[model samples]
Target: MQNDDKYLKSKNENPGSGMPIDEMHELDRTLGFKERRYIEELRILTKSTAIDCIIDDRFERIIYVVRQGDMGIAIGKGGDNIKKMSRVLGKRIEMVEFDEDREVFIANMFKPAEVASVSFGERDEPVMVTVPERGDFGLAIGKGGSTIEKARILVRRFYGKEVGDILIPNRGNL
Candidate 1:
């Protein structure tokens, strides 16, 4: 729940890339070193309210901590930061913000793709996200199932929730 505890928990849950980042030896760890430096670099370049940078099998998505009313500064002026990061990292870059509320957090994860609703199932089960339209389906799920994996990992890390699936209604049927 505390800031330090959050990163520690995040490192544990997101083992694919989190590594061991503790208050004592963050810079000593290779993964921690790289991530911290990258985050700083992003901050200097974008001057945004970034929380952290998550590197996953799919691509990198920078997480920011924007205030509730303000739109995210995650994407810099005219998306310049995103473009530069994409060129520098050689991977598609996505952005999301951290929220105290899990439902809002889930909505942030699937940004640009409007979420109609979000509800949790049984404990230790998946969380469901409803999108407004079918066209947003692919973007919510990501190419090759990567985005959903990112969502699941982050959910587990941040909220201790494991997402089994992000279901989209069949607009064709309607």
Candidate 2:
């Protein structure tokens, strides 16, 4: 009987721990509850649409992307909602607006310097952007070209492609 039991145990012991599906389900349930509550709180506070919520357990942070016509309303009066949410969640909360129009979002990203256009270069490839003249090209590129570089990195990191070119339109060209 003891030998038989040992053989069964050995057979049941999977090499890869048999995929933690039960644990994942539990985590999903917990996250769902938290997300629902957070959405409710946000609705009460701002009356804006919470487009998406990303909970990063490793960083202990919650990133909320909201679709709002007015950023002020999403942030709340005097940043009260953000403060409250951060305190309640016990995690840093970052807010970003979700624009229905892709152009609007891209334009918003290149602040101060107006973006003329954003066009995809190739499939699974980099993007090409056109920006208006804004005094210092260095500023547009950012310190040590960090700004544009970071944007490129983010594009590749998020979209799985590099940005082929970034063109700043010259007054002479126009």
Query: What lDDT tens digits, residue by residue, belong to model 2 across residues 32-138?
Result: 77775776667676676664456656456675655546466867788887888788778876564545454454444444455678775455555666776645344
lDDT of 2: 0.52
Q: Each prediction's Cα lDDT score?
A: 0.59, 0.52
The CA lDDT at 49 in model 2 is: 60
Evaluated at residue 32, the lDDT of candidate 1 is 65
Candidate 1 ranges with C-alpha deviation above 4 Å? 1-31, 58-72, 169-174
* Per-candidate TM-score against the hidden true structure: 0.68, 0.49
Give the worst 10-residue stretch by lDDT in candidate 2. 1-10
Structure candidate 2, residue pairs in collision = 126-162
**What TM value does model 1 have?**
0.68
